[model samples]
Target: MPNPDNSTPPIPSSVLILGSGVFGLSTALSLSTHPSFTHSTITLVDRSAFPAPDSASIDTSRIIRADYADPAYSALAAKASKHWRGEWGADGRYDEVGLCLVADSGKAEYVKKSLQNVQGLVKSGARQAGQGRAGKDSVQVLDTREEIERVMNTGGGSGESGYVNWASGWADAEAAMRYCRRKVEELGRVNFRKAEAKSLLYSGNKVIGVELVDGGRILADLTVVATGAWSGKLVDLRGIASATGQVLAYLDITQEEQDRLGKIPVLLNMSTGIFVIPPRDRVLKVARHAYGYSNPTRVPHPEKHSESMVVSLPRTKVDEPDQWIPREGELACRKALREMIPSLGDRPFSYTRICWYTDTPTGDWLITHHPCYEGLFLATGGSGHGFKFLPVIGDKIVDCILGKTPEEFRDKWSWPEKGKEDGVWTDDGSRGGKKGSVLDEEMRKGSRL
Candidate 1:
């Protein structure tokens, strides 16, 4: 990847981002927004040109507002949602059509339990804030199918029913990404470069900068790896696994059919592990859970789920950053959707896309310092719930980089957990693993600079 034309002034500080995905762009946006970053040069390197709506070149349509079943994730999502609304202003780009989690009688029991759990957290948070009523109003558990239908119709402005409502929602991924990038550009110091990082440049144990694929080197005082699925290639040089997971989407219904289902809330069917989001455009975006993948070297499932990536891909390399288009066997997924909804059986697909997820072994986010590498930050292993936290993920990373102690994050996003005698060092580095070392070396290096 080439640097900006030499005719222009050099970047203030060489902040190099390896990937141009949502996470990478979000981090850059957060940094560019900081008061101290007024003159700090920030560069975002990616494989594609600036993305736009309807551009198949880059798929940024992965954002969601669904709260997770896990406490760590629910807390993270809650924070991210707040940040998103704050930054975007009222109706910035996301449509808060609310989220619907549909399930059968048996699966509804699980949904009910999960709703109870989320309600307890919300009430607890509000009570601490001195609010009188429990926030349980946000997590109503619908009993009758008619009640489910009424909630979906009235809540989402769709005027239709037959969908269960959950305490979650949807956002326009492309719009949100563009909003962040525009905010970054507003700073004028942040640089958006079209490049691909080849390797991390290191001075002994400390990382200095990144070398691009096309022979360009961008120096950085601090380097962060927000490269999502492709992070493996960048961090494995330091001996950490990136654990790639595959995700696929299908638009089985026609544009007319999708329009007929206008503004439907994002629906998550936990029983089948499928999510259907109704975008403004005449398209229904459906994605299945990343069950697991046989390539354990590239992916790890904490739930003991069966491997499903290879089974999901279409012969060609689908997991790569630039190469993801549906081929074969994707129709089977559409067929399954048709079986579930019945309305989708005859409708032709608008388009199908495949995406990748970077998973950690423990299921919790592996937001930690790179072992043995100073000045390098590793932000991967978000599992499948990374996008839901995009609004605050960048802020947290920036907080970490600024040396300010993020009290909540410090207690939550810890070192990866070790499973058995796998020899994988998963400590927060306080007990037996290496944690504080990276920060210490980074401080020392910065002082020398």
Candidate 2:
């Protein structure tokens, strides 16, 4: 551990990863299967079991949509969408309930381009023989607010135009992760440790390993921190990332209601910051796509970075007991749901969870080396939209570690100035400005946090 020169040690025979969420597991699995990574030992460490209950990735459902106002993200996600098809023997992993984009204007960048993008892919694929059944009847543009409401199976969207990628739908997120998990386990080169990482073990500016909560040491040539909302507590990301909770509501429906709500497409209204997923197993998931909560149960970072703080309020399943289903979050969700599904607004929520996103300055992900510590890298900041890209995000992280990241995504995800990015008029700074918070903002009294 005498790496005083601050230079990278060398080609790592072993990789020690913190957190077994999507990023951690996928990166390990991808590296283990890579021809170049032969014989390399990849160790994945987490505080809880795989698919931990509190992991944002452990939800019963998560939206896997290509609906985005940005073209770059849309293109990347659209290509990765195909892998959702029946992953690991689970049928309908990529359900066909349709991905409906509902926004205030038919001309919204996300609305217009997503329609063209999916439609183009379908038509182009149709021309080539031996194409899979992924894009048949894929895209449909709905003009007028009433039309959007009609497709949404409700009656409140009064001014919007959007489209539906009818071929696209939600993914059984928890199931897909388990599938990948089994595959990783089969590799045998990757080991899972149910231990919490207390801090990074460094040698003069070079990361030599990680220190576990139990006072254990894990030495590796390279250490990648893929911890989700808890990333800030483990390393120094320099304020580029923070943990913000997004709340989702699940409503229990009777068989009759399920028959009607089950077919509803993943309804996303970009203007409203909400989306409704298709009902499954007599339950429907609806969530606000904005920042929900910002309580830092972990030590606050002086620089306000994710890797520098550890969030302790979350468990393997949900947020802290006191943080569950705030009255304000529920009201906001109900209002948004009523806009698209009026019946859902009338029904009480069966349960709620705040999906913690390791949010960053840009809507893009962070998959780069740690500038402060050599031989250490980071691959988090899913920004609430990382699950759907499961098919390929891991390989990208490997590329980041190997210095092979494509130019398009390289700098966009690099560290940023949090104070500058989180300035006034800049909501979450991931997608757009004016993000919602979980504090039940007292807007009525002209008082804000």
Candidate 3:
């Protein structure tokens, strides 16, 4: 018989986090700060190295506070922005430089509607919470294309003619992730393992521990899976299922295109369905929002930025967060950016990278206790906005671990009652008829088209 001491200690409380991304680290840091978690140990597991040499290579940081059309996400983002600047320390890593939404004259109506809702929400509760305060609230709304042009001129124009907002920006993504990870590591209660999780050890319906790729069995009282893209595969082993999404990013311009891509406020070009983020140096960042691949797999190692360019090659099912840069992808992204913003012209791209998103049919993140497992928690399906909510997610995840469900958390991530098969259902307008779930009827009303 196995020694009783070797099994989980009676009333065990240690937590095993199954990824090193922002979600895993953020949860570890928050648990350290939690009053009830003083005695708990947090074991963070990630295949990524400790102190990633290239921050961007590990996970590109694209932080923003733009309120989404979805109210639930807006609320979550507002809380996250506060924690990033307040809890994580403003000067630590995340910088609130503000963000702007841009659109062409033809799509002015769409931009206006979206911004109206965002502005209303911001002005209503966000301002009271100090989530955002537009440049003295003087020019919160840019009604004219000429005004946008003037602001664009001052911010080192996007190279293309379009209307712009003045009071928005982006955070240093690479720096923010690094800072969060560092803070978590500094907490003496947590241990980061440089190994991959090979399988889960379960008893009856509960997970008892995880078997590492190296064959070490590190047991835990509870397990939290924040595996991002590899989540589907990891969960599949345990009979849990999720969808994967593939995303890519490209440098906006090279060092030579200083006049065109530098000093620009981060922009979300609604007309083009693209987001343009201004990084340090002359390089700008650009990527499509609507286009993405489904059924992505994880790659144990990072890939180069070059391998991602070929549209012909079967899309790689990267299971892990790889940083390989495909040369052709780098060239293609740079060219596409130039086409979008003519000012980029013929400048070369310095680098490019790919990342993955855990997706859901209802488009809401699945961050709760596993429906079937008693001691397992989930923090996945951010729908691409998970990183921005790292700070707030940490607090909620810890609460879930401690068995105290907060009111705010209950409202945001409550489990769906419908669509058990494909995990999809249309919102039926009940008191709990939240819009961002698998059953959201409104958002996908015409999805068949």
Most lDDT-accurate candidate: 2
Against the correct fold, how does model 1 do in TM-score? 0.71
What tens-digit string does per-residue lDDT give for candidate 1 at 84-128?
Answer: 555662463555555666565544444555555566667777212
Q: What value does the lDDT take at residue 50 in candidate 2? A: 72
What are the lDDT figures for the candidates, one per model?
0.51, 0.68, 0.53
Q: Which regions of candidate 1 fall more than 4 Å away from where they truly are?
A: 1-14, 35-39, 52-63, 83-92, 103-113, 121-137, 144-167, 237-247, 252-256, 292-332, 403-408, 417-449
Write down the TM-score of every candidate.
0.71, 0.85, 0.73
- Cα displacement (angstroms), candidate 3, residue 333, comes to 4.6
In candidate 3 the C-alpha lDDT for residue 115 amounts to 61
Sort by TM-score, best first: 2, 3, 1
Give the better candidate number (1 or 2) by lDDT.
2
Per-prediction RMSD in angstroms?
12.5, 4.9, 9.6
Q: List model 2 lDDT by residue over 14-133, tens digit each.
A: 889898888988998899888777877888999887778888888777777665555566666666765665453256565657777766653366566666655655665621211223
